[model samples]
Structure formats: C-alpha cells, structure tokens
Target: MSGSGSIITVLDMFGARLPGDLAFSLSQCGSISADHPLAGEIAAALGGKAASLPYPRRQDFMWVTLAPTAEQLRCVIEDLRCWVLPSFGWESSPPIVSDGGPAGRMGALLLAQSPQGYFRWHSRPADTDHVIARLATMRAVIAQAPARLSQLRPTLEMLRRQFTLGLATGDRDMALQAIDEIDQRQLDTASNALSMSIRVAAAFGDDQAIVDHPQLDNLLSMRVPQRVIESVLLAHHAVFLADLEAAGDIKAALAAYLPLHDRLSGLAGHPADDADTGIVRMAAYDAALAEDARRLHLLADRFAGDTVVAALVASPPPIAPLPILEPAGQPAPETEAQSVEPAFGEPLQPSVAELETVRVAPVAVTAEPALPLGWSDVPALVATSAREPLAALLQHAALMPDACDPGDGDFLIELLTDSEIIADTKKRAQADQVLTTVIDAYVCEERFPRRERLGLYETVLDIWSSSRALSTDPIDGQLLLTMADALLRLNGHLEAAVATMITRWWEARPVRSRLAWLGEALELLTEQSSAQDYLGLWYAGAGLINVDHEGFSVADRYLWYRLGRRLGLDGTATDEALGVDWLPLHSADDPLLAAGFRKIAIVSLHERAAREAAAQIEDRTQAHVVLVTDHAAGEGTASAATADVILFVWGAAKHAVYRAFDKVRDRLEYVQGTGSASIVRALERRVRAAGG
Candidate 1:
C-alpha cells in the first residue's frame, strides 16, 4: 500500500497514447502474473499491435523494441543490463536521454520506478570517427568462441540497424566503413547476400571505393548461402561490369572483371534450383560483350584519314619545298602571301594573284555517296536490338502491324522456350512481359481489326496452351478479358467468355474486386442497354468465392441507364448529368431508347422472392407473377394472357436467358403495360412484321 503511489506514477508514465510499441510493450507489464486472466487477453491484443500505431509508423522503433510480460517489475531491468545497456555502456552512458521533453516527462511520470526506464534528460552526438568501431571491438570477443558466440548473432543484427541509420543519415563513408568492419571482423565465411547486393548497388558512383577495396569480389565469390542469391549476384555483377566498361577505363576495367565474367559464364549450365525459377536470360547482353574486343579494335583502326591522304598527294609537305618547274620558257613561283601590285588603284588580293599565275586543272572524281540503312537493315541484322525500341513498339502497338515478320510471333515463342531466359525468377517475369506484349498486339482492335483478329487470338492461345503446359501469366489473362469484351460487342457468346476467363482465377478475393472495378468501368462506357450487361456482371463476379452486394447495384445502374428516358434517366437527364456524350444514345444510330414505347412485351425472369419483393412495384407496373422457370405453358410458368408482366426466371446461369429465348414468346406480343417486358416484346414484333 505504501508503494501504491509509486506504482500509480509508473502507470501514468504509459499515459493515454504510448509513443511507440516499445514504450507500450514496456508499459502493459509489471507485477501481473502470467496465469492471471488478463495475461492472455493483453498479449493477444499486443500481437501485431504495431500496425495500430498512429497513422504512419516510424521505422526506428521496429527493431530494439522492449516486450516484457506483466509479471515482473525488473524483467525489463534484467533485459536492459543484459542486451541494451552493456553494449551501450549504460553504467556510464545509456542508449537514450529524456531531457523532460514530452516523451521524457511522460516516460518519467509513468516509469517512476528508477533504473528500468531511467534516462538522462539530455545528451550530445557521438565523437567517434567510426560508428562501427564499437562493433569492431565486440567482434573480437564473439570470435573467441567463449560460449557467448550464440549471443553474437543478435548483437551483430544491432550493428545492421546502425548501418541502416547510417544509410538514412546519408553517411556513405560511415556505411562503407561499417560494412568493411563486418567483412573483416564478424563474418568469417561470406557476407549475407541481401546486404552484399545492396552494397554493390550503392557503390555504383563510387569507383574509387570499389577499386581501392576488393571486398565485392569476396562477397560475390563466397561459396555457400542460397543458389538463388548466387545466380542473382552473378547477373548483377555482369551488368555492373558491362556498364563500367562502357563508361570507365575499358582496358583496365575488363582486365579486372573478365575473370569474374568467365567464371559466371561457366556457371550458365548450373542446375535449375529454386532461385533459377524467375530468371530470364539476356542472350543479347552476352552477344554484345562478345563484340567488345572487336569494337575496341574498330575504334582504334584510324588508318590515315581521307584528309591526311589527300593533303599528302596534292600538296607539298610543310618543311619540304616545291621548287618552281620551269615550263619551257616560264617560271612557276607566285605562291607567297606577299603584296602583289596589279597596275590598279587597290592592292591585289592573294586569290587574284594566284588565279593570274597558276594553271591547275579541275578533277572530276566519280564516286557516289552511300545510302542510309532503312527498315530492311535493322530487320536483317536483328542480333542485338535496343530494349528502348521494344518498349516503344509495345507502347504504340497500334502503329506496328508488322513489328514482327509474318511468322515471327511463333519464332518469338520458340526463342523464349529455348533460351536461358528462365534461368532465374527475375528473368522468368521478363519472359512473361515479352509474351504478354505479343498477345496484347494481336488482340488490339485498331491494329489487327476484326477481319481476322479472332484467328490471331486462337493462334496465340493455341501456342500458349500447347507450350510446356504452363499456367497463363496474369497479364496474358488480360488478353482473354479484352477478347471477351470484344465478343460481347460483336454479339457473340458473352457468357462463355465470362465463364472461360473466370474459371481458374475467380477464387482470389482481391482479383474479384479488380473484376468489379472493370465491370463498373465498362457499364459507365455504355450507350444503351444490351444483353452485354450480363457479361459485365459475370466478369466482375467471376473471380470471387463470395461477392459483395455491389454487384447488384452495378446491375441496377445498367438496367436503369439502358431503359433511359422511361426510367427518367436519358435525354435531358443524361445531359444534366454528363455535359455531352460524343455518341449520344438518342442519336440516329440508336432510336430504340429515344422512343420509350408503352407496348412491346418479353418474358422477364427473376426468382419468386424477387417478384414478391417487387410486390409494391405491382401497383405501378402491370406485371403477372410468373413462378421461376415457367416459360412455354410449363407447370412453373404463368399463362400468357391479359396485359401483364411475362416474368421469365433466369437462375444462376445468366446465359440461360439467351438459351431459353425460343420459349420467351412463340411470336412477339404487344405487351401493353409497364416494365421492360412490354417494350422489349413490342419492338421484336415490330421488327419481325416489318421484314420487307
């Protein structure tokens, strides 16, 4: 009871909102037994409680956080003495300072318990040149193998956090020094692949650092870790070496790097392990490097330029004089820039004097200028095409109908299959991109058009489905989506389109959301109601195990928009909503929606519950309740008598509507009543009767 005030102060230090998880973790602790009722509840809430931090999470608190059970007051103190403080020299200097700031005061007010949450009010930055010097000192102790080496792993991890801090502070020299210390002191085998890769990339601009230290060679050449890491490292080094050769001292650079390249090239046939799954090979990079020595030779093959040779043959050498040749009776020496007087008022120019004396004849050299290489040249020599052009070709595919030759799509597929492009996971993804571009081109409307574009789709799909029996890449699936979209517009099998694309992929929930968004995008792009709306709904709903109520709303919006003015949504209604539509639904192109007729009836299908739910609509709409699936005088169907709604029940299969079209009405009826059936039925009858 006497210490209640002190405990109260400790609790107060935690406050309403903990500054960080470490602070919070340290707070929900103290004197509460593990078997207590609150223990399970508290720990469960703490799991991933870092996610519930205020809005944006600070990265600093991710590591070095303190998590203590509520049972012990000094559990944190024991932890402080063992892990946090000893390395930090907490006996003399703690890891943190308080200074009575908001955090400091709050911490003090809560942790009124001394020692465990103690901190100095203020402090200054480190005076050491190497932030890692402390780590370098500790590495010696850990390497001694004094039974404390197991503790070495976590301590070194703390060193990694410090390295990240160095990165954040933009301290390159400190970062480099720290890495050098790790390689030199702690790691006897090889540096971690992820850490080493980051260092190599970071050293891109720092040639002096790379050349002065061959630590990269050690990092890359290390024997064992993960094969994926090894393959990735090899590729990364190959790219870096190629870049440096282009921009730096080619001779010196290649001499230092050729050995590495040869070693990596020798590893080309290394068995496909887990890491090799995503790799895509770049044969062009290999081919380009093969020409490096030849290119160097070509650049240096400056064998006496045309200007030098022409000067040698036509003019005398600078020091060697050309004596005047006496032409029988005349001397031929009027070649100095001296003033020569012609008996005129002005001094004669050098050109005038030279023309008067020299009798040189004109020479006509018969030579034609070279014509530049056009499309034929590039297509012929397609050995090493630039990646930039490929990007452009894919981006503006509309312009590139002949991007590949007539049978070249097949050639590309074969090339992908045969090459080491899938040598690793990274490159495997690239292969997918290459394949997707080809598919996107063939499926595009403006590029291929409808004349035979569907044939292209069949060809590509055949090639894909037949090859290696691999699953279609997600991007390639988009090709099917586009085709489905087109088939719907062409009045082809929209339901089949939906079913085929959705069959394998609809199981993922997020994929369903994407489909839903796409459907909404399509509906908002419509002119009037068509059966295509069903495809859109099916497409959006295709990828979900469980769908949201949003699908119903999408269907409702489309139905209302399709019905238009009768539903009070088209004509002036649309104009009030959208400023202008380029192809207005009420235009000469489409007059169906323009005239909302009262006649015309077709069978509308919905569940029995739906009819009962629209019961209030019965007062306003003249609809006869037809039990579901009751078309053509069947037991479940309603009689086609009186002006009432011919409700046709469409079950889960949206395509059943089209399949059951024959039973909808033997001939169209002038459905003189409310709802979609009346207008639809009347229009069909009008079209059939006016068949002139």
Candidate 2:
C-alpha cells in the first residue's frame, strides 16, 4: 500500500480473512502479519496454505496464517527469500530475514498493523541488515506512518535502532550520521547520542574523530547520569590506548595514562548506581573495558622496570575510614575519636588569635537535638582547629549559609590551605569541593554581603597564587577561571593571579586544550576591560605563536583578533603586535598594494570596526572606501553595487544583508573577522591571488 490509510485497510482486510481464534492465537504469540504479493510461493515453501483477501474497490492481496513449523519458517525465510514473522509459539528465537529489499516495506506494513509488534520485531538482530540496507525505505515508511504510530512511538526509537545496528555492523559513518540526525532533531537523547558516537569512533579506531567530536565536552558539562559519564571516559581511555599503540611510545603513554588510571581506579571502587538499580547491562561496554584493562596490564608488564608502572600494577593502598565527629557541648563517648597523624607534620594547636576571630552568636536551647557540626557548632569547629573532622564535615555537609559572615569565610580558607589537608589527594579533592561549595553559596547565589564576597574573592586569589601555581591541570585551571570570572563580574578587575595563570597555561604548550582555556580567558578579559596592556599580553603569548604548530588553528586566530579589536586596538597596532607589518603592506610601490581596489565597500554590524577597516584599506592602497552600515539604506546598497570590491564581514554582518548583496557576490570578498587588520589581510590575499 502506498499510503498509511490504504495500508491500514489492507491490514484490516487481511485480518478479516483470518478466523477469530487464529487472530487471537497470533496476537498471543506476538506475531505480526504483512500482505505479500508472492504469498503463495511463501506458503508453498512452508508447506502451508494461502488465501486471497478481497478489498472493496482495491487490488486483492494474498495472506497466510503466521503459524508454521520452525523448519518450515527457516526454509521460507532463508531459501524462498520471503518475510516470515517469528514462530507462532516461540518469542525468543527471532527469524533472520534476508535483506531482499522488501523486508523494510513489510516492516512498514507490520508497523501499521501493530506498532508494538513492529518495535519488538526490530529490537532483535533479525532486522539489523535490513534496516541498514533499506534505510531510505524505512525512513520514508516512518515519515508517512499514521498519526497514531507517530504519537505513540516517535522517531527517536527508530534512530536509536539504526544507531545500534550501525554499531553492530561496525559502520562508523552510518552510526555517526544517525547521531548527527539525532542532534539536529534536538532529541532528548543528547547524552545517549554523544556516548554512542564516541563508542563508534573508538571502535572504528578513529582516534582523531573522538578527540574532535564537538559534543564530547557538551556531554561532560551536562548533569548526566554516572553510568553515561563513566562510559564516555572509558571510551576516551580506549582512544588513548589506540594512539599509544599507533605511536609505539611506552614512556609517553604511561605518563598520560597515570592520571586517567588514578581517576578511573577511584571510580571503580565506587560503582555507579546503575549496578544496583538493575539497569540493562552494556555488554559492548563491559567487553571494551575488559579488553582495555588487559592491554593496560600487558603494557605495564612490558614496562615493569619503570617505577610508575610497577607501583600501578601493585596492590592499591588501603584507604583509612573516616571517624565521626561530635557537636560542641555534646557529651563525649567513653572512647575518644581516634585521630590520624597529619600527613604534613605534627598538628598545630589552635592559636588564641584564631579562636578570637570566630564570632559566636547566642543560641536558644530547643527540645530537639541538633545534628553534629550544625550551624551553632561551626564556631567551635573553627576555634578548636578540629581540622580532620572539619574537613570531613565540609565534604559531606551542605555548606549553604544563612548569612554572609567573615568568620565562615576565614575558616573555609584556612581549611583549604591547610598543609595537612593538601597533602592527601582525597583530602585535597575534598578541599576543592569545599571551595566550589563556598563559591556557589557566596558568589553565585548573590545573597551574601558584597564586602564579604569581595573578601572571599581575594582569599581565593591568594590560595591560587600560593598553592595552585605549579598545577597545570586543566580542571584546576577551569575552576580558577570560573572564580576569576566571578571576581570580574563583581569588581570589574582581572586579578594578576589569573593573568599569571593564563600565561603559565599558554606557555605550557600551544595545544588545543590550552588554547581553549586562553580563548575563555580572553573573552573574560575583553568583557571586563579594554586595557591594551592586558590584552596585548595574550596577543603576544597566543596570537604570536607559530602557525605551523598543531593547535593554533585559523579559528583561534580569528577569535584573537576579534577580541583584540574589541579591546580598542586598531589595524596598525594589532598588525605591529604580531609583526604583520613586515609584510608588503608597508611598501607603497608593491604590486599587491598598487593592484588593490580603487573603491571598496565594507559591510559590518560593528560601526567603529567597519570605519577602521575602511581607513586601513584607504591608507594601505590609496583607494576610496565606502562604509555599508545598514542593509536597507539605499546609499549603502548603491555603494556596495558599484564598488570595485565588496568586503562582507561574515562574522559581524547580518545574514539578510549578505543575501541582499548577492547580486554583487562575484566581486564580494567574505571577511571572517570584524577587525581592521583582518580586513586588510583578506584584501591583500585576494589581490595577490588575482595575480597582482
């Protein structure tokens, strides 16, 4: 049937041909029917009978009962090349239908009859090859399905099925395309799509694809379930191993794997909640993890002489249990709390000055007892230097405050910077947890007093300078920048601590990760202030890096110049900063300069940038400059039409304006950035390419 209405009618006519008892039996056995033109041939293959079904004012079709012997169904499916429903009584042994091109059409008919049956049938492996081979037919069928089928089960399930089939067949391109469609449709399966795409890329040994996939970070930034995040990270580790094997570099790979190994080990100790929730087991995921672990152990054995690998494969260190702490003024138990010795050195007793700094407010005694280390007990914890239990409390406790108090801020900073706390990795993580919690409460919530918040910002800066200087960890850098952004929003000042951190991160390497962080830092700096000295520091550090390097991409340059212009630098200054003036732009008699346009039109949304670009062009080539500030302005349109060259600032111009200038597109040069130097650079390239 061509349309869904006709397909439904055909299904109804076929049902009418079946006896009520037979129909009920077929329904009970979870069998779906499709009217086939060669139903007689299929019946002969199965040694069954076929009946002709009559339809009012439509072509008659042949139908057969779903009940058939297992051997007969196998013969009909494999030999006769006909679609056969799963055996009438058995639901587990799904028949493997050949990809004879009619299977998808038959699936469409079955879908019209029973959508649930359609899904159940496709969920098995029988439909995998058929789904891939007749993908276009299946798509059309789904698109033209009845509204009932569309409403009950949307296209998301179909997309997931295709993705699953692609993975099963090792069709990486197909799987990635399915994921892209899911993203384009704005489906709610964003996390699932991202995880699937990563696994697909890793399975196909496309390590670069996994690294360059745009949604990887987006998925990480989401509040995804623990299982999903773990799966993504495991896939990342697999990519790392693949790269390592390809390079044949054991030492470098070991160095990269240690941090990831530590992180994964920590996660492995605490399995995700999915294990206990009885969710469906991911067999592929488990198999991949096991394989990766085996490979890792092999690598470790090969490099057993190396100390790090030896220590890694060795038995893990035992983790000490955390002791419970009692609130202030509570009666102590017969046994005292056992305190472990600080890792740094002997524990220092609380000073009198530190005790005096904690302000204790009056509290009313209530009938119900308060929890340990509650609000009232904070002052005591701060005053007594109860570092160990206080660190535990901060880790597990909700740090939301009722008021902005300098006393709470001081105690948190003290706990975070405590040498004893920073010595252990777990405790250091807990300290970071406390820092983020305080930031969320004091900075993000904005319920705290401004003066107190500023004081906390300064304390954070001091902590970063003193303790985090040597850390090149991207996660730590992100957290630092987050705090810096918060501080900038409050006081409109970029702390020198942040500036130094950015410089250090950039100089560490010109890798993509570092460049991404620099881009974020540049955005923040540009937003807060247009100080040339501050902006020039980044330009010198990042913008001046060798283009031959792997990480300094064209997109990165565009961003740097765009932000530089936003910081009040003109074409000449920006060009000089990057030594671009050494080019032929300074020579008036240069052929490229002489061959430049007599009249050029620049279109942009940023008026000052547009004017500056125009000035730069006129100064370099002695050409007349026309500024197109508005798309609808007649004078702008007229100037754009007659100009010898039209420079459309692609990043800063509206799409409607670009379209309006389509009549002059032949002479139009698409400029990527709104900066004056970018425009001049583009013009020079165009002239040179035109045989100037």
Candidate 3:
C-alpha cells in the first residue's frame, strides 16, 4: 500500500497481463544480472532494458528495487519459495529449507504479515531470574485489574442515581447519600454535582436541600468528614434555629440537633470540632428547658392562678410544728424573727444568730400582796407574773357598774405605771389607750356601742408583742411583758392561755422559718370557736402583711382573702377588717358626680378601697367611676389620661399606688383621708366650686 497524506493511493496491476511469465531462483545477493530468469520481465514491466533492475541491499534471501520510473517507484522483498514460478506440470511437494533461508544474528527482527494483522513480538537478552520476575509481576496486575473495576461498577451506578434524584427533587438526604457514595467510590464528577446542588439549596434556604434540611444536623455524628459541606450546613442550621426562635417555638428551637451557633463561631474564631460542639448543644438544650420549667413553676406558685391545691401541697401551711419552749436555764435554739412574726417583718427582724438570748419560764408566784377590790388572788394568774395581779385589777375596773367610773379608769392607769416591763413609750401609750377605751366603754354607755373591746385587745397585744419580739428598731423588750399582762386582762382566761403560749413562742425557735405564727394562731382561734369577725380581721391583717408588703415574696394575699371570706363578715364588718372607713361616706353619691361629672377616677392603694369607692360613685352619679390601684397599672394610665375628675386619695396609700397617678394631677378635684367626712367634704367642695 502506498499513501499520500492520510489518503491511500492504490495501483492494482497484479492480475494484469504481463509481457511474459518469468521464473527465478531466489538468493541473497547484491546484484541482479541480465541472466536472471525474471530480469527481462521486470525490465519489460518497467518498460526498460534488463540492466535497469536495481540491487538495493543483500537480504536473508533476496531484496529488489525497481529503478525510479517517471510515474512511480517501489521496493519489495520476494519469497521466491512462495512466489508462483513458471514450472513443469505435475510435481507438488513441500520444500525443505537447507539453512532456514539465511540465518543471521539473533538481533535481527523477524517481521511477519498475516491476514489478521501485522504482529511484532520483541525479546531482549536477560538473565533467567530477571525475566521470570518481570513475567510474574505482569501476571499479578492482569489478574486483579478486572476484578477491581467490576467491584466498583455497582457503587458508581448508585452514586449516579443518587445524584440524578437529588437534582430532580430537592431531596437533601438523597443528595447527601450520593455525595457519600461518590466519596467512597472516588467518583469525583458525581461528588461535585451533588455538592453544587447542596450549595444551591443552602443559598436559597431550600427545605429539602442537604445544607438547609434539619437532617443535616446528623453530620455531627457522621464518621466520615464532610469538609466542603459542613460549614454550609452549620450556617443553615443557625438560620433555621433563629427562625424557630423568632416564631416562639422555644422548645423546638432549643431542641435543634446541633450547637450551630457555637460551631459557626468556632469556624470563624476558634477551632472546635463536631464532637465538642455536640456536647455543648446537648448541655444548652437541657439547661434551657430546666430554666423555663423553673420560671413557670415559680410564677404559678406566686400567682396562685388556678393552682391553689398545688400551692398548698408544695408549701404546706405552718411549715412544721413550733418547738415546745422549755423553762428557764434550759433554753431552746434561738428562733429567726422571720419565723414568729409575719413575712412582712422578715427583712426587719434580726438574723437568728443576732437575736438576744431569751429564756422561757413560768411567772414566779410569791404570796399575793394586799389585793385590790374585785382582784382576788388566782394561783395561775399570780404564778404567771406580779403584773398578772394588776391585769386582774384592770379587768374588774372595766366591768364595774358605775356611770362615771373614775375608779375603773384610774385602775388602768395604775396597771400601766405599776408594771416595770412597760418600757417602750409608744407601746405603753398604746396600751394606755386600749385600757382607757375598755374602762370608758362601761363608764359611758354612749361609747359602749362603738367599743370593739376584744378587737382592741388583740390589735394592741399584737403590736406590743411584735415590737418586743420582732422589732429591728431600737425598742425595749419589756413591752412584751406589758402586752402579755394586757392580753390577760382583756380576754380573761382565753387571753391568759394565749399569753403563756406567746411567751413560750417568743423564747423558742420555729421549725418553719418562712411561716408566720398567725397561721398557727388562726387554727387555734378557729378550733376554740372564737369570734368570726375577730378571725376575719386577723386573717385580713396577716394576709396584707405576708403578701402586699415589701418583706415577703410568697403570695398569701388571696389565701387570706379566701380564709376571711369563710368568716362570713357582713359588708360593714368586712370593711372594718380590711381597714377601710368608706362605708359611712359611701351612703350617698359624691356631690361632684351629681354636678354632671362624666368620669370619676377613685384611686386607692388597696383593692377593697377602690372597689368600695367605685360602688359609691356609681350610686351617686351618671359618671363612670374607674377604680385605680397599683395592680391596675394599665387601668390607672387609661383612666388618668381620660377621666374628667380624679379623687386622689392622700390617706393610707402605698407609694406604688401614688406613683401610678403621675398623669392625672391636673384633673384632681378632690382629696380624701381615711375618714368619712374628709371624703364627703372634698366632694361637696368640688360641687360648690362647680356651681352644682
């Protein structure tokens, strides 16, 4: 074959008629002679003389070259044995080679052509060991190559399918699986495609994309590192958590599978790995839920919402029983002042360690000194204290049947002066007032109807004992001795029993430090069938101090309110118990409201006062009366901004309630105190000024 550029130029003349059939014997020679058998025909094919045949080289057999013609030139090797030579008719036999045609050096190449194709097999001189080793190595590689390729085919196919599914549907799991498979199979192209899809999903915040999906959080536990996608997934996780937080799915947001913020922060500023970040995430989620549950429980406990039973169960009343007080020289542990007095006094009381050591002992009874009239010696009363004899003197003085009993009134004064224990000046004065009221109740029949004898005794005794036992102020302790004496005179036997107990509690330690003694006292009073009105008043007082005051953190306001309700106080009595004096003033409408007031705001520190004022204002006028207190911060602001007239209470108001009236000073047309006249006069003055 001959070619030009990439094209083949074939000239077929093998079957064409020649000048003649020539036969020749082949030999390895450098010359072709005219005497050669085929020389004439070759010369004729070339259209030249016989001398034109060229001798190119000596071959193993023969090599021939035709001289260049005007048209074409060529070279060829002829196997004279295989060449068809003109021969006589019948002899057909295999020729035996004498020298195997022309043996040459072993370096000589043997080129062979066959119908199949050209083949070249090379062999170089080597030692026997070298050849054998080279063949063995080749054999090993050839044996394993096919198996390795076959093993990876299924894996590559799976990766391709995963990649296809990831692209078609925004399925992050499929995409991640595909990426994982590609990594395992070393399929670089498929991994790149899946990674690109992740990038798109992350960019758009696609819900099902590998980077944005919640399942991406699982990467924290994955063993194989996902270096390229990890950072993107972390960022997307942060965004998702923030969204949940903004939507107020607090639990779900905290439940996020990764510490995404910490992870991203680590990436930017530190170098925390997934394992550390996962531990932090778990800790944060647990802490968040714990804190939330704690706050909710605290709020519930404090507010008492619908959780009355729960509150009672969680904090049982009276805490533990009061430890029994021993006699003198065998003192019990010191009690925290917070334990005996109401919670409102907790901040004011001395700490347990700071309180003075006081011991409880029964009063010494010597032979009674010359007894006064109607004050015969009683052993228990005398043994209690020398002052107990004087209390008996006052009790008789109060009940003496004289229209103007100077003896009874003077008798109370003697008791106050005779007792060395009546030390606090204010407490002594309060006791004097209480004794005078009781004695005067009998002396003047007019004041007798107004006398709250038992109430007066309880209130004064409570104040005096509180001053002596719980006072943080610079006050004398002797006042409690005076109070116990006064309680004995007022209630007689009942007062004596309670006074003894009070003296014991004063010297003993309380088991439940946060509970007030009043809770226990109320139980005793109730069981003893004491007056309901007195019990109601006690409940109201304790309730207010324990909840509404600055010292306590627990909620006892509603609890006491409910307990007081059980006492069945009438409207007037309930008002008295709550320390409000608006009933007499509430009988008629305020004159100002009758003078065409459109809206009247009654602002009080207490809820009951506000409620009472609202009722009175409604009764008197067509104006709408809004009750404003500290609890009604919203209502206060609303009414103060819009009301036509404000009845500013300057009496018994807490600072909190006063602070709520900042916007309503201009419309304040009336000012009232704790009395009925102050309220009525203020309203009347406003009416007169308005020409009503």
Candidate 4:
C-alpha cells in the first residue's frame, strides 16, 4: 500500500501507520514529522513487522528525526532489490515512493542544519523540480523556526542556503506561498508545532513584512556584534507593518553595531582609548570616497566619477594591460572584428563620450520604450535587466552569418556595451540576454569598443578598491571574468588573453583537460617577458592571502596559505628578495582558522580587518596550526562546510569527490551549452557555491 503523492495520498496511505502530521489529525497517530510521517512506516512496510518503533516520528525524517541516511537508503535498496523483494519473487528493485527526492533531501538537510533534526540523508538531484519544490517548503519552515523556537533563525538561515532555491527562476512566489501555509498552521496543545509565525512571514517577497512583525522589531533591536547584520536583517524582517518604527530600529541597530565596512578592527596603539580614534578613523580615508560611489548606485543616482576617483586612491595593482589590446586576437583580416562597420547604427570612432547623451540617466523623466519597466515602475520585482533582446543575442551569436565581415560584428559588440546595457543588474535568470550578447561577440570574434570595456573595468576597479565596492559580490566580479573567459575561449584566443585579464586569484579549472590548457596559457605569459611575467604572477598571487581560512579542511586550505613558499621556488635570488608577507599559515584547528572561524570571517579578512581580532582555536582538536584560506568568502562560497568527508561507518559523512561528480554529471551535461561544454563545466565547478 506504499506510495508517494499529494497531502491526501499521504494521509490515506499512512494515516493509521504513523504519528506526526497525519496522526494529529487522525487522533490515533501523533508521532511523526509532517514532511514524512511514514519514513519509518514505509521502511517498515518493506517488511510487515515495522510496528516496532515509537511514534510521533522523531521530529524530522532526515537528520533529527526519521529520515534514512544515504547508506541506509542504499542498504534498503539492496535489501529490497536483492533480498526482500526477491522473497516476493520480484526481479527489479522496488521503486520507493517519495515527494520529490531532492526536496526530501533538502528537508533532511535543513533539519540537520540545526540541532533540529538528528539524521541526514545525502543524495543528488534525481529529480530537480521536486527538489526545487521541496526547497521552497524547507526555506519557509526554516524562516519560521526562530519565532517558534527562539533565536535559531540566523543559524537556520545559514543552513537554508545549503539548498539552492534552485530558482534562478529566482521567483519569490514559490517561497512566499510555502511560508504562508506554515504560518497558517497553529501549534496549540494538540499541535506540537515549533511555531515561528513571525519567521514564516519573513519569507515574504516583501522585506517590510519582517520589519512589521509584532515582536520582531524589539528582538532585532538588540545590539549583537557588528558582524551579524545579515542576521539582524533577517530577524528585523519578522517585525511587521509599522515600517518607520522598524526602520528607526534598523538604523539604531546599525549604529550600535559600530563597525563600518571600512572599520579596521584590530588596530593597535590605544584603540578604544578614546583619544586616538580619529587618528586611524580616517586611515583608509579614501575608502569613504569609494563608499560614495556605492551609495549613489544604491540610490540610482549619478555618482560623479571623481567622487569614485577620490574614494579610490591606489593606482590599480599594475595589472598587465591585456597586451592583445584587441578582443579580436588575430591580425587584421578585414573581417568582422578588425575593420570598422559604419553601416549599422553609428560609426565606431572609439569615442565613448556619447554616453553622456545616450546612456540612460538616473533621473530621466521619460522611460523610452527600449527600456523595459523595472524596479521603479513595477509593483513587483520583475527581472528586466537582460530581458532586452536576450534570446536574440544567443541566436545571433550562435548562428553568426558566415558571410558577415568586421562592420556588423563591431556594431553589435559596441551596441551591447552601451552604458545603459552594461549597467543593468537584472536578475540572473534574465542575464542570459546580456551574456548572450557577450557570448555572440566572442563566438564571432567581434571586437567591442575597447574604450568602453576599459572604462567599465576601471569603474569596477574603483568600485572595489575602497571596501565600498565589494569584491565579494560573486556575480559581478569573478563570475564576470568567467563569462568573459568563456567568450574569449570560444574565439580561441581565450588561451593567450585570459590570464592577462583575470587575476590569478581565481583558479576555476578542475576538469583536468581545461587546467592543463590554462597551464599552457600561463606558460605563454611567462614566456612573453619572463621578469615582468613573474612580477605579474607575484602580484596576482598577492590576491590570495588569508582568503577564506574557515570553510575548508586543514590540508586543502593549507595549500593556498603557503603562497609565498610556492613563489621563488625556482631558487631565483631575485624572486626571493621581493619578499611578500603572506598572511601567516593557519591550520584547520589553528588558533585562527577554525577558531569560531565561521563567525565574522569575511569582514575580518576583507573589510574591518582586525587581523587577530577573532582568531581562536578553529577546531577543538589538539592539532597545531589551523589551515586558513586566501578568500574568507572562499570557504563560504566553496561550501567547504557542507562537503562530505569519506566515512568508514554508516553514520559518518563522505567527501567523495568522484562519487559527488558522478552524481551531478548528467545535470551538468544537460545544462551545458553547445561547443562550450568544457568551459561551462569548468565554471559550474567554480561558481556554483562550495560544497555543491
């Protein structure tokens, strides 16, 4: 009688069999988690003697409750397939019913994230849509946890991220709907619900719901450390409708936190002494200017370039000016890339000054039809950034006219980089449009306006220079390089040109063939001008220090911290003298690496860098020296925390890369684009978050 289905099917199949959700409604049953009351019932149903275990299903089916471990599931499969089902004379494994396998797995993961659940079932995306649906439900449950349980919201919120909303279709509707249902259910004397009605409401697409919660504002107003702002943001969302009061609380809470993105925490020589706060108050004074640029963009105003320039003082770390200079890579072929194509739009005379007149101004009174209505106009967050001719860009590039020459390609490339086009931060699912434009240009080896590209690069540099710009915003910074790399690689010059454009900070090549090739490219760079190349290498390597020391295992992370040691290894007396002061090597259990490494790691490393401020024994182990990362965000981004370590016992987790890779290969292959499979796979490995 076992089966998986809608809420009705679950009640029909397991109402008498289990205790939790169904049992509460059915009177005779009261001991199982709602998502899977019959995990044990079904497992026991495999035989018929399953009535042995107690009811109210252990709170959760995955980790905290009734869920089977991956190994147990494997055992179940084998037992049923080989032994149990065979007794019934079945030749094949019985297909176990489930409500979206990945979604179930996601629930299990969410439960395990906190002390909420006692078990976890690790699995891969067998069915993506199911997983997506389940994830929506899980996030709703997690968002509601804090109010129901008191203060576990931040921790659960962190865990919530483990399951990708699988929405890039990043729609708010699914998440919002699930959140609403969870809120509707009351956990009274008969309802054993760990109710956080305030939390469930936090999942609303509107941030104000959280801020308007009856009790959320007061709870959020408490001054936690400056590091926990995101948590505060999450908690404050629980606060309900009187937004001005909530906004006042937010501003106050922010003030009490006292740490700015630029505040240097571990300052020595009488900090908190009150007399000298101003001395170092403006130490990185220029960062204020950078913040000026940030504030403007957030407000959608035109921040003057000099404001950005003043905020950004350091000359860009002498990056090699992409020596090729031309995106076309090859010599003048009188082809689409090299020669001017004056036929379409306007002539390409290299003057980007026309931007003042043509670029979309922040205060433009009239919205042109070319511009799709967006955040300002729409009542909802419709992702309009790349909706502009997105699908066309891909087709145009993918099916480049075999007969077209330089003019057409130039016109297309130049048009794509226009200020209005480039500045659009449309939601990612929609980004395919802009990227398609870039990709097509690459496919046809078309040269864009070099001046525009350089200007954008300079602006990016300015934005990032003063902690105000935020290099950690993944999609904007490194991912851009990845996309850029894909385009260059498509044109075949990706090899000779990439290393010059991207910092060595990002080493995305995991699929060996690609790494071997990138290695070959680096070789060319080294050969081009040995000394200058080495300097570039060292300069690039400098970007790696104390990165993300927390998230990785001791050994894997140690490899990165030893950057200085890797440099000058060839015994060059000259290379040795350059003497880079790499952040000291840290072990996983080291005082700094694991020492509550999870808390405030990013800001400590990048923003309010208090070098030794929060360093503690990372692992409680007796091991000396902890392993740290080159990018604190690296550990978080890489998902090092969730990566499984190989286990010998059924209870232990495994960090089986091969097994993991095998599980997701099909999904990767399915999502990969034409003629660009290798590059796409390489990037998915790098940017799809860490443990994933």
Q: Could you report the Cα RMSD, in angstroms, for every candidate shown? A: 31.2, 30.6, 48.8, 30.2
Better of 1 and 3 by lDDT: 3
- TM-scores, each model vs. reference: 0.22, 0.29, 0.20, 0.22
The TM-score between candidate 2 and the true structure equals 0.29
- Candidate 2: tens digits of C-alpha lDDT, residues 321-402: 1122222355744533223322211222444563332222111111122335543343345445566656545433322133
Summarize candidate 1's per-residue lDDT along 369-452 as a digit string, tens digits: 222432222222223444455444443332232333324344445435544554545344444545544543344211222534
Better of 1 and 4 by lDDT: 1
Candidate 2 ranges beyond 4 A from true positions? 1-392, 395-400, 403-408, 425-429, 443-452, 464-475, 493-512, 549-555, 564-692
Clashes of each: 28, 0, 2, 77
- What is the RMSD, in Å, between candidate 4 and the native fold over all Cα? 30.2
- Greater TM-score among 1 and 3 belongs to 1
Clashing pairs in 3: 363-384, 589-620
- Ten contiguous residues with the weakest lDDT in model 3: 107-116
Q: lDDT at 208 for candidate 4?
A: 43
Candidate 4: where are CA atoms >4 Å away? 1-412, 418-432, 436-472, 480-496, 503-534, 540-692
